[model samples]
Target: MLSPASIVPVILAGGSGTRLWPVSRDSLPKQFQSLHGTNTLYQDTLKRVSDRSLFSAPIVLTHEDFRFFARRQAQDIGIDTTVVLEPTRRDSGPALLAAAMVAQRLAGEGCLVLALAADHVVLDEALFVDACRAAGRAASDGHIVTFGITPTEPSTAYGYIRPGSAAGTSEARKVDAFVEKPDTVTAARYLAEGYLWNSGNFLFPASLLIEEAERFEPAIVAAVREAVELSVEDLGFIRLDAKAFADSPAKSIDYAVMEKTTRAAVVEGKFRWSDIGSWDALRALEPGDAAGNVTHGPVTLLDSTNNYIHTDGPLVATVGVDNLAVVATEDAVLVMPASRSQDVKALVAKLKSDRHNAASEHLKAHRPWGTYQTICRGERFHVKKIVVEPGGRLSLQKHYHRAEHWIVVKGTAEVTLDGRVFEVRENESTYLPLGGVHRLANPGKIPLELIEVQTGSYLGEDDIVRLEDVYNRS
Candidate 1:
């Protein structure tokens, strides 16, 4: 009997997710949202393919700002994560390349990488894992393998994959051609002719990818090679050289490597899959009531059939809305015909141009140690509800302008004020005067919840000057 092949999963979790707005913001993307079940899509993805012996620790490629969120998700699901943070905003080509480099370093030769998006949901996890193993086997034989999801319906929203020939198996198919997102009529014909939806999932030998990178895009290969060779191990994150990586040309695998290489192959995924790109796509997958309404959070709909109303917190009530998407948040509410759900990005653009904070940021912001939500703010005072996860701690830092008063509501807190360490329990309060270095943490097994009242001349996040942190914040 052969030992199971070593597989490394590389999760790309850097999407803006504009269509699912009001709830999904730049600070908190859709990959982090619990749209369908209790776990976020990324967390679900981790659980789907989690096998400690077969797969190594997951290598996550995401934005610098979302590192903490990604780390927290991995912790929540108990998946040991090796996070790779991108210093600059680039597309999946560079992102995947960076992650592939890290994965190569971890698994070395004869190993396979399973690269996948963070926000996709597979209805059949068993089938998905089976496909992954097959793809890994194919990859070990020096082929770049991709998963071609079986299309359930005509979808113009996703790129279509044209299967060339059967590659020695009933399940594996060679690529005849790759088509970009098509027109409605083209999608209909592809769906009828048994074309598969390009699932954007890949499995490849690390050497194959590295060689292809060097062949087609030599500059990227050099830069990435140098970045990997000189990478600094920072706590848990693998820090690539920012300048070296930023110097590489930005391109996707299709454009940079896969389309130009002869080692490309596709495997038919037996599971049901959805990218959930837009609200229309999401609504179509959501379970609807007898009246055909999919409602989440707090929503009331009257005569609203075949509609989706999603909210984060604010109560939403719809009347006579047929085939529409109604989403409401604390600061924004959007009502659009479900047909035009893709237009939500345009609305977000308008909001951004209008300087609306709702478009770019969330009312609740997550840090490496914890999360803080803005409660109230006046001229010189600001209020916030802060929750520090168990074993999480804030930075030992000083604020130049703001003084903070913390009232613990639940759980235990380890407080460090001006280099003095102390414990603050439930219902206890503490104050940190301005210019005093302080830190907050939950050193217990439960969540640390606190109400923070701030009084300052300039109550801003930039007022913080960090001395030290467990999460490597400077």
Candidate 2:
């Protein structure tokens, strides 16, 4: 059996949350955003497993598009991590197998793997760590263990696990069966019958999990094994082979192995947990005022009860409104009854069907260097507010159909125009002629802020021709 300190955390961070629209999109999902406290959900997950005595360095499994986001956020919290990039979306089945393969490569077959979802919130960190240690022990004894949260309510948002009998002398129990999300009546019955909410976190030895997966789905094992073998190191991240990984079927671990295995076990978690899947879930987690209202940012309320109001743009004020959720951002706003928050996913799907830009793209676009927000846009013209961190640099490229003008508002900008590099101080401005090679960099210690104005026939982001890029983007 492996020791408690031999556990390796394999965090899953590639979910594209659509229910929390306007704030969570394909570009920046809910895991990377600060929804609960000061830190993002991803950062919170990292901190939960940061104890060096119990857990080793984490391996974050995410998509290729989110590699930089994962890296930067981990750096922000002073946590070192190994990032694995999945070339495509292939559900938790491939993700877990890939994690096992990577963990085995790093710590050998004897180490235990603690799989965690990056978008969950646990109010009790001490209880969570204790449960992880217990689950690690159970997993070390040749069993695939999953943590089950004690159900505080009849939640239709989560699945349920039926624990059969005790596993040996420990508190862990053998799983009877895994059930899907049930209706209100079924959920209440499950809650009253002493079933636990499936938290989607699992623990097992690397070798044993591979064996179980191979028995249930041999094609997935073959594909993920080859993908890991052919994986390439790019920008300090492991990029799995695209073709080999994509050959595997998209299925969750519960479907591929947990339901089919005989050694499935579960440990009870008494801590408060929530996936934060909808606005109602988030509101229930936060402390409400006297009127049962949860709010964030610049929000004002009068005669509103049981409402959730949030805004990061203009001041949001409400009156005589009850059981509603009003969320507003710089570019979009979502207004719905709190009871119908689950229907936001359908609304997002409708927006995507209509080809709306708000369906996926946010006003603020993040890049490897920094972020740029669209300030204004009109026919034949576009304006942007750009922020570059210290030592950050843009690609050396030229626009095909647009000429640009930049006004530095803060710090200094190292501008490269037509192979001539010079520094522009605060309040200084520079111009880039059409078809001229240009680049932007922040050579100062402080962050550089600038306003960029573009005039051209096409202002689409795809109009750039990259001459060189430090980020290795094509």
Model 2's TM-score against the true structure:
0.98
Candidate 1: where is the Cα deviation over 4 Å? 1-3, 52-54, 168-170, 411-431, 443-445
lDDT of 1 by residue, 206-231 (tens): 77888887889998888777777777
| Candidate 2 residue lDDT tens string, 1-474 | 345459999999999999999889998999999999999999999999999889999999999889999999999999999999999999999999999999999988788999999999999999999898778778867789999999999999999999999877667899999999999999999999999999999998889999999999999999999999999999899999999999999999999999999999999998999998988888888889999999999988888998999887689999899988999998899999889999999999999999998899999999998999999999999999999999999999999899999999999999999889999988999999999999999988999999999999999999999888988885
The lowest-lDDT stretch of 10 consecutive residues in candidate 2 is 1-10
Question: What residue pairs are clashing in model 2?
Answer: none
Q: Which portions of model 2 show Cα errors greater than 4 Å?
A: 1-4
The best candidate in terms of lDDT: 2
lDDT, each prediction: 0.84, 0.93
